[model samples]
Target: MEQGSHLLFWKAVNTVILIAILYYLLKKPISRFISDGINSVVSRFEKIKQEKEEALNLLKEAERKSQEAKEEAEKIIKYSQELAEKEKQQIIAEAKIAAERVIKMADEEIEKEIYKAKEELKKFAAKKAVELAEEKLKVAIDVESNKKLIESSLQKL
Candidate 1:
């Protein structure tokens, strides 16, 4: 077997040229494209992370405001309860006063009715007694001697 130095040298030169051409024409563009795509992905991930952090902050603020509103509502309910209690007490006081007035009025009316009934009974009794006395005198006297009895009684007095 006879080896040719000429073929070996040509192969070495050809491999070197091919490596240079590939590096210049394909390796740089492919590497640059891959690097740009990785950068874009990393930037998009950062943007999403920032947006998530902002959303969490907003949620926290909303929770705080909701708690404040609940506290305010409880205070208002307490105030209204107090007002209702005061109104109930006032109503009870007014009712008591009204009942006292009504009792006093009823007592006065009863006293007036008793006094009027006594007066009416006395007047009726006096009228009946006067009629009975006139009837007894007429029974004891004679009709023919009525004028002579009257004149003799008048002269004796």
Candidate 2:
């Protein structure tokens, strides 16, 4: 029993010494490997964060451009509408002037026709009166009356 106890004590001391030697030899390499891995992860995280920020900036720029384009389009539409309205007013004014000119021409033509008709009627009435007076003289007077009328006109002169 005494020999077994002595042997166990030596074995325990040997195991402890072996463990300490292994620890001393491996500690630096393990720490270096862990730090390198952490550095790699941190660098990758920074790169991702920078990319996200760039993408957000690009989105904001695109939104600004879109808003500008919309405003420009509205301006163009407004200008086109104003131009159309102006053209419409000009066309309407031109049409009114043309209509008035046509109406004036028609009225002038009507007045000319009425004057011509009145002149023709006056000529016709004068010719008809001359014919009626000649016929009445032939029916009512004889040769004796004509001789008397001539002698009286001569005596009076």
Candidate 3:
């Protein structure tokens, strides 16, 4: 072989030895770093999944509580309506009774007034009759007739 070719061959051998030594030195560290990164990524993914499940459970619980609240509100509204209706009925009944009582009282008062008016009319008629009778006697009985009546009454007595 020539000298130049022999030197190039030695340089190629030296380059191969250096590359192999570097690969051997870096292999374990690089592999360990890649494995640790993969484990971290898997752990993070699992944690996220667990968090999502917890969020879904919380949402379901909130929905259930909301439904219960709605049911309770309906019941309360129904009860209030029933109570209001009962109160309205009671008030109407009480008003009717009060009206009846007022009407009865008015009737009794009217009757009393009518009776009083009749009594006054009877008294007025009796007074007028007495005055008329007195006037009639005064006109019919002259002085001479009165003297004769007195003499007859004395004789009878």
lDDT values of the candidates? 0.93, 0.96, 0.96
Candidate 3 lDDT at 49 equals 96
Residue 25 CA displacement from its true place in model 1, Å = 2.9
TM-score of each: 0.71, 0.65, 0.73
Q: Taking the tens digit of each residue's C-alpha lDDT, what string does model 1 give over 45-145?
A: 99999999999999999999999999999999999999999999999999999999999999999999999999999998998999998898888777857
lDDT (tens digit, per residue) of candidate 3 on 65-94: 999999999999999999999999999999
**In terms of TM-score, how similar is model 2 to the real structure?**
0.65
lDDT of 1: 0.93
Q: Which stretches of candidate 1 lie over 4 Å from their true place?
A: 1-20, 136-157
Question: Of the candidates numbered 1 and 2, which has the greater lDDT value?
Answer: 2
Who is ahead in lDDT, 1 or 3?
A: 3
